[model samples]
Target: MKEKLVVFSGAGMSAESGINTFRDSNGLWEKYDIYEIATPEAWNKNPELVTDFYNQRRKNILNVKVNQAHLEIAKMENLFEVTVITQNIDNLHERAGSSNVVHLHGNITLAKSSGPNPEKKYYPIKSWRLTKNDLCEDGYRLRPHVVWFGETVPMLMEAQNIIEQADYFLVIGTSLQVYPAAGLVHHAIKAKKKLILDPKVSEMQVPNDFLKIEMTATSGIIEALDLMR
Candidate 1:
């Protein structure tokens, strides 16, 4: 059987692909207030602004191509049972051909009902333009599928289960600052090897067992694959 390689990725993984990271200097957060753009309260107050914000993000995803880091991770599926657990909302991993992916935060390319049970069904946004006119079958407005702040991460348990069974656990491009998601690394106790690839590894406080590769995702993933081999 192929070894189970579980990869946990974050905004940094897609940063090189031209997707802006929220916490970086002059990043998205610098331009927009988190409370105004990424909170349930904001959506309640101004759904149009929230909808338009995600629409632009979806358009951004459509314009950007998958980078070398994404392709490298996808290629690993040939050698292992690769399951990607990503905090990003983009579809680049799937576009790059990774068979199994779990989006911890959610996918921006899709829309869900603004109804109470938003998780019941996900509707694919045809062209990165989900407007207020868009409504689910239940007759509620369609909202971006992303998990906003003050929202529970529905996929967290499933991610933990996958991590617990991993033979190799790889963390890429994440600052490990986000909660619940950041705590996932602790579930990989059974993993024979654990590694994190990022340029700012020195600033991270990870478990002692992790092999830190302090490089950008594109270069770091290549080095990580070589070391694994």
Candidate 2:
């Protein structure tokens, strides 16, 4: 059996592909108020605004390509059973040919029903525009399938289990600042090898045993793969 290799990725993983990180010094959060655009309160207060914000982001993401780092990570499958647990809502990991991926947040390409019903149905949208008119089969407004702030992270347990089984654990681009997601590193503490790829290492808090490759994702991934080989 191939050794299990788990990769935990964040916004930095997709940033090189032209997607913006929300927590960087010059990230999207700098321009937009988090409570106004990325919280459940915002969604309830102005659903149209929330929809518009995600629609624009989806459009931007559609225009971006899967970068080399994604490809390199997928290539790891040749030597290991690779599983990607990403905080990014983009489908770049899947697009890059990764067989298994768990999105810690929600996928941006999908929309879920806002109905009062107990069950929520997700619908795939071909266009970047998700308007208020878009409705699920239950005749309720469709909202972006993203895990906004103040909402529970439904995939946390699954991610934790994946990390705990890792023979080798890798974290790419993420600063390890976000709660719950950041806590995943603790699960992989017993892994044979652990590596973190990020240029801004000074700001991150990670295990001392983790191999810190202080560089951009692309270069860091290349060096990491070489070291693994």
Off by over 4 Å in 2: 116-119
lDDT of 1 at 151: 98
Q: For residue 161, what is the lDDT in candidate 1?
A: 95
Candidate 1's TM-score: 0.99
Candidate 1 runs further than 4 Å off? none
Against the reference, the lDDT scores of all candidates come to 0.93, 0.87
lDDT, model 2, position 199: 88
- lDDT, residue 225, model 2: 70
RMSD of 1: 0.7
Candidate 1 has its poorest 10 consecutive residues by lDDT at: 220-229
Please list the Cα RMSD from the true structure of every candidate, rounded to 1 decimal place.
0.7, 1.4
lDDT of 1 by residue, 111-225 (tens): 9999898999999999979988999999999999999999999999999999999999999999899898999989998888899998999998989999999999998898897
Query: Candidate 1's error at 77, in angstroms?
Result: 0.9
